[model samples]
Target: MMDEPNPPVWPDSVIIVHDTEDADTMKQKLEPTQDSWNAEHNTFTCDYHFSDRRYAVLFTPGIYRNVDLEVGYYVQVAGLGVTPNHVQFKGDGKGPHVPSLNRHIHKNSGTCLDTFWRSGENFSCANDMVWAVSQASPLRRVHCQKDLYLHDKDAYASGGHIANAVVDGHTHFGGQQQYLSRNVHFGKGASGGAWSMVYVGCGDNAPPNSATNTTITKTRVRVEKPYIAVYDDDKTKFQLRIPLVNDGTTDNLPQVTGDNEESRDFRHVKVATASESTRAIQKALDEGKDVVLTPGIYYLDQSLDVHKDNQVVLGLGLATLVSPVGSPCIRVAPGTAGVRIAGVMLEAPAVDPAKRKSTESHWSLLEYGCEGQTQADDPKNPGALFDIFCRVGGGGDADKRHWINIDSMVRIHSSHVIGDNLWLWRADHAELNPGESPNCPNVSPVFYQTEKDEYNVDTGIVVTGDNVTIYGLAVEHTSKHQTIWKGENGAVYFYQCEFPYDVDTDFGKAGYRGYFIGNSVKAHSLNSPGIYSNFRNATVQVETAIQHPDSPEIEVVNPFTVHLDNNGIIASVINGRGPAAQKQGVPSRV
Candidate 1:
């Protein structure tokens, strides 16, 4: 056996299991009388619950056989390995078969328990290990040779976040608001009953709220057959973006898509300057051709309207589209479908920081589906955005810095708009020289620092359209809500957000949340499997993480007092021991 790396210094609450002897020793430490009793078989079970206590179970690298482990509130089960496959759990049991000695049969309905099973290196399991766990309990980095069921066969499960793992058999999620990220592969099974890599809400009496909100990001499928096959319900609030390529090569297995070129095709355009570039782009769009902008700075006096369907506007090598004062850079007309905007940087007109008291508002750099009434029929082909970067500041002069004070960086009114790797930034640090005409003006450096809130942009993204999906969205330092989703059935994969560090009092003492889901509408979902935020001011830290109720699996690191509002209920507090809290970081407030 490979020597195990030095174990992490766990908190006093964690239980370390090194061998079979350690498992027995720890069982006594938790209260032997509390052990589960199986009256049907008249046998004593090994399932132990710490009740209100919060703890973690760390297993060293080894092969553990027939160990039926169930955790309770604030309990974490982790293996010490470089990847998940290092620690192996083997048994002869299959399906819902639990060892007679120490097994806890999973129930379908009850108060959801918050538990976690993860690995540092690689973890693998031979039998169907996790047969009974709720949405609160997550299993991570476990390669299962046999099927690894999440919830009971008959009952509907709730919420969980599974990351970086693979299962040879079908992996079922009979719950709602579940997130699967990073290389989760499902094996290709027989073509008969439920032959899908990932199964969502597949129970007969599944809850009405179950299986509606699910997100799969950067995941892969090993089978040649169709990856996800939904049954018994409409996969309405679902998002599948940036999937790893499944090339038909035995050696390659699951090949990751190389550069942006491999993902889509585009017609390359090299322009000497900004003049007539708009007309040239319009002509190309009119012909139903995708466009690729070569490396250059292009200025747009008027918005480049995308009226044609299935058009792609891709940029190469930091290609920039700059808008003049009070003009939007790009606009996607109504009824346009399959429109893609990628690898481009958008800049709004700069404003003098010295004029901080002005009530004038700036325009958004990009607007999509903002025209006409909402379509009742779902869009046949949705638009997509990949690696789009946007900035608001340009000019120099710390005191008189040039900035963009727009209502929002991006506005979406269309349905089924998917985004992968989007960054909407308000430049905190200046770049261009002062008094440089349009880009910069002579201003005092002190004014820039003292009037930081005055120079900041209002919001990052405002969505009014339905079925919009975003994968990696990072919006930093906006004055109001950094991202506001007024639309219904929206999905987000991973969001990295930070509140403005420089804001003093323009947005009240509570500051603002990184994202806000409108309370007027229901059925909007956000699966921020990995979300990180930090605030500068102490008073500004206490803001809601998200407004919607169905949002699940938000991992916040080193955050100042923040609240997670799921639907209308206050689901959890940042760094709290509730279902949303991380087990490793700062101690839970609960």
Candidate 2:
């Protein structure tokens, strides 16, 4: 028999709470002050007087009745149980029972939960679950018996990541950039009511169809209702991969159809070493078989080209492709359809220690489509990427140095490309050195900061093709425009972006925007969005959230700005505030 995995050790920074305590005692322990009082003795409230500390609250198993809690930034609430349902938070109320009433609402605006559950009546709207979270804080391993609401009307909520969850009732993701993965159920009924899973924008008057850019992957529906619905205006902005299928049972781990077919469909080619990777992959492509890359770092002196149609390049755990200093990593030829690249990390070349301030020489790490391909609009055939992670720097001894100084991380020149769970990061958080002298020798803490005349990456994604769809696009800390969409009819669902944090005098002082839509573009869409910019030292500010002159139907739920110091300290924050739509010549909306 196999041994059960040991429970995760709670960090020392976590606060341990138990259900054995009375309501009053528990409230005091959570708030630690009377400045934010629990007026009804049921809701634990924390006001502005509360300290801004990153905290994790671990709850022992038990039911705490009639409890509603409020928290602020960088707080994580988790249940200490073998499974998510082992711990319960139940309340007495159902829908419309106002002030001092029956509903249990965890009115957390800027917080996170590892697992949040409530038990009472499964069908009652009164048993609603609500929270407002950001990208830095994600909800993991959560199972809620009640309907989940991202944000109430009053709070500005940006969407975060949700994984391995089960919701018995409807889930309303009304924030920006919400990504759902490996979820069991969402919405219970087929009717167009509160039981239907809906995504909407945050404006008070925004219609249910105002929600944009929400992505769902590897999720199933429990009931026979509309599995997923977007706002009338947001049809193209939502990307659905592995559609929510019903397996005719309540099994959380149901045997999904085609679950094992991916392995059989592709001809698995295992490359033993980095030296043989490029040649092996090319041979597989030539043989009209899909290539499977096992776990290892594959160094490429030249670009690995995919020319055939319906070719899939799959990778196992931690399989990475590293590019040389001045070469393209991977290229997809034009007119190629249904090409998939999944489960891999792409790394740009490491920065040379001797030329710390020199410019990088690559054009792009990954380029899709040939330069002169006919830009035809074809939805029937497309290129796709699943669970792809890309990094530009911070892979070696010294942290924060720009490894790949390219014009774009991903440049798409072809149409109808779909991306799921795409994360392009210019590493901001890492240890300078680990082992050697004290911690490490010759380590630089602020390598992300640009020196005079040093080369830097310009953008995360530059889309020149039409009808390109991305489910979860997260780009952080690029030098200039984070994402620039010039393509026609491009749809982006669930975009999570963060501006460079360690910008100082060494970094140049201007022209950085979270997203820049090209002026010539006519139709582009984005939904379920979160864009955060934290400026500490440099005067460079984003030109505008959206720069497209021909106003696209873009919906952003929460956009934030923070001012911090060079030492990574927050001085002030303007949360849930985005640029004016009218300034970009788009229709005025929040």
Candidate 3:
């Protein structure tokens, strides 16, 4: 038997709070006054759009009454309980409404549009909850007893995702351009979707099947990210919760403690703080430690290499990794097995002009294993990437830079890997002005400089691994193909993509494909994939939304493409097969 390891001594930034005598007291403990709270909670409310600080606020298993938890930028609020029901926010008639959890309302706009990089998981709200967020933010394993509103006001939201939760009331998607809900139970059902809405393996009042509102009755397999939870009986002991594989089932509870080895083995766990350097982090990984990154941005001077099996690198509060010199931030060594990376953002920041060659561009931000290093399939312990996001620009000084150089966001070369809730994006615009627009002007906007300027990302994801599975994936605004699949027997549950909007006349007539499968691949499958285009700079047409070999083994179900605006047209769905969706308000399918 493995020796028992010591419990993790969490950093000061991670706040652990228990039930108090009153809700007001608990709220005060969670967030003190605005000035002091910025230091204690790391809650940078003033820097709502971008901040380097990260924080994780954990609630111990208990019932709290009439407390409205306002989650701020880069803050993660989670419940430390065996199940979500154990931590309840109830209405005790001390306030106007039931206990609610909401995003920090921006002081200028009073909207949730820019509420990004924050998350809430494993908790229950007695009544209404507002989570008006865009990309890179996720809500998982949450139970909402009443209404769930997606928007706080009239501001527009780009996209969002929700998975593994139960909602007894209606979910209102107001002003959200798109959304994805997987493995959820909706008792009262969903109300609105502006562009696209997809439901996979959901139960109770499922949306009527349509091309726009796509619904998949069953999912083949789903493995959730491992989470940290306090022991229900002994609060002092923290156990790692490994989720069970969901085979089209509503709920497949994980194995109880004493039966799961991981629950007891913390010997290899290493809690990492943002103050440490990349050398320190690499040293911990070299010692075969699973590093837990606290809330903060890591500036990697060198790649953090992971070369072992079952090694986990978990991040809290949207912990970001930035490559300042145009190099990869994280790289899994060749033939490495079962390296799990979750809740992290890989960002390609502006490279210094002196440090970068004029003709050079970085290949990838995060790489899973090396190309052509084949190994036997490890289905039981596949390399898993959950809630992993990649970005080219749109935060910090990234928007002010004239050039951004990243060829691809992620490259997966290890066979039999699973990716869930992966979003690879190249920002099309910069942050808006904070003022209510009564006097403030639009400050910075991204513009194409020259032909050699790597303004936007070339691609989002490049997959060379066989038997790779992805769920709830979104790739947007790439200069080339959004996703390139080269291996055999790959499957995608739900895919949302948007082609580059700035394909100008100087660019050739040959447009980019959204999902491109190599001709050498024998088998692949896609379910409910949507590609949209909005060529605002020039009138252009893409030859195909998806390009794949037409074979019986290669199955594509319910694939559609739509022209969002500006005379952008996609001629075909896959291999010159489906109708085109041009002219506003029209959708075409294959």
- For residue 265, give model 2's deviation from the true position in Å: 5.3
Order candidates by TM-score, high to low.
3, 2, 1
Q: Model-by-model lDDT, in order?
A: 0.47, 0.49, 0.72
Give lDDT tens digits, candidate 3, residues 157-176: 76788887878899888777
Give residue 257's error in model 2 in angstroms: 2.8
**Where does the lowest 10-residue lDDT sum fall in candidate 3?**
94-103
In model 3, what lDDT does residue 300 have?
84
| Model 1 Cα lDDT, one tens digit per residue, 402-475 | 35466678888888777655678775434333453322122222113213553457888988888776654667
Output the number of the TM-score-best candidate. Answer: 3
Identify the runs in model 2 with alpha carbons over 4 angstroms from their true place.
1-184, 187-255, 259-275, 351-362, 375-377, 399-404, 434-455, 504-509, 551-589
Prediction 2 TM-score vs. true: 0.56
- Which segments of model 3 are wrong by more than 4 Å? 1-9, 21-25, 29-47, 92-114, 151-155, 232-236, 244-261, 264-267, 324-326, 357-362, 398-400, 432-455, 506-508
What does candidate 2's lDDT look like per residue over 473-567, in tens digits? 77877777789888887776566676776566333235456777787877776654445554544544443444455453543333333322223
What lDDT does candidate 3 reach at residue 19? 69
